[model samples]
Target: MANIFNIMDFLWAPWRSKYVADSSKSKREEKCIFCEFPEQNDDERNLIVYRSKYAYIILNRFPYNPSHVMIVPYRHISSVELLEDNEAQDIFRLIKITLAAIRKVYSPDGFNIGINIGRTAGAGIEAHVHVHIVPRWNGDANFMPVLSNTKVLPEDLETTYVKLKKAIEDIINNEDSLDH
Candidate 1:
């Protein structure tokens, strides 16, 4: 009898190649992207939409959904427990802002907000602690991730950044007006 299970198949996802390639690098040898992206002084190119004293909001280059973003502290740390009071507060505040912005722009049905501290816990950058805010909609989960380990996003990152940046700015401005 022929070995039917031995046949090979390929799923062409060129966009995921960078992530797959980077996965091979030793964590210690790689510079923390959360640290490096901020220092580059190019917020738009970096996909950083908002910055606060202790934390900032940046879009996830590889996203589970259209408006996925992360709230990252300026100081690099491995766990939330290591966060200083100000950093924690700033991150929390930014989370609220991010939520409002995503709601205003994407109008997601719901959200998945989480922090993955260690590599075992799903932290892609184990050296840095950040909170991810993934906007979710009803019936968003599909066969792609289950079958092919792929996610199909409708919009590109640049478009998402533009819409989110504007929404964040508008939200901040509205809050400022309310405070006055």
Candidate 2:
């Protein structure tokens, strides 16, 4: 008889290979993605939606849900306590902007906003601190993840990125107009 769990292991989640491979690399060998992404010029290719003075918002390449993103500071620091006052403020501001943008785009029933500080605490990139904002809908926690150990996202990353990018830009522009 074949073990169901063994069969499940062969589930075709090709996109997860990068995440699995990266996680296995030693700290000395791996570059901080949060730090390196913003340094690049291609926002669309990098999945970066918005940028502020001290922080930026980037889509999670491996997402728990559609339109999931992280608010990351430019400076690579592992802990919340290490954040400068300005950086902290910028991150919080970006969080608000991101929430609004997500609402405009996904209209999720709720959200899971969090920061994992260390490897033990579930920080995938423990060397760089960032905030994950996962949009949640009613009954989103379905059988796929529990039964098959997989999450089926309805929207592709590129489409989600385009919609979110436009929403963020529009929201920021509106806020700027309101302030002026």
Candidate 3:
């Protein structure tokens, strides 16, 4: 009975977040799902913009909020330590630019940026190491995610994507001028 209870606890662990109640990881949904957003022509759904030789930035489809973005290396390396020096530097640069893009688009009060390494560490796709930059505001926390188990996104994903894409493009194009 104790062993069965321990198994149940492990199975239902993600629900402790209150926002994510469904244990979908075990169903292979949170496994090695790699997405090639830059290669696709659909910029709206894929939310890709400002691709570089070593890294690319894309908006998260399931965002924590509007204008949430992620910076990913072109190579699908799972660990940050495994990244080449050029890839490592380029990835962080993209992340900084993406944060600026999000700020220019959404004007959020703050941001939450992080990377989940393994599946147990909340990496929905553990095969890829991507950094998430989530825009946040004061009182962004609400009851919808807590009570109904639904994340209440403020704006349409497409609209947010378009706005962010343009901001990133402007930044990249004017980067040289902004350097001064």
Candidate number achieving the greatest TM-score relative to the actual structure:
2
Candidate 2: misplaced stretches above 4 Å? 1-21, 26-28, 176-180
User: What lDDT is reached at residue 11 by model 1?
Assistant: 38
lDDT scores of the candidates, listed in order: 0.86, 0.87, 0.73
Clashing pairs in 3: none
TM-score of 1: 0.84
lDDT of 3 at 174: 82
Q: How do the candidates rank by lDDT, highest first? A: 2, 1, 3
What lDDT tens digits, residue by residue, belong to model 2 across residues 1-180?
Answer: 977788658746554666767765736577877887788878999999988999999999889899999999999899999999999989998888888889987899999999999878978889999999999999987677656767789999999999999998898888764333
Q: Cα deviation in Å at residue 115, candidate 1?
A: 0.3
lDDT of 3: 0.73
Model 2 C-alpha lDDT versus the unseen true structure: 0.87
Worst 10 residues of 1 by lDDT: 6-15
lDDT of 1 by residue, 113-157 (tens): 999888788778888899999999998977786567667899999
The TM-scores, one per candidate, come to: 0.84, 0.84, 0.78
Q: In candidate 3, which residue ranges exceed 4 Å CA deviation?
A: 1-35, 177-180
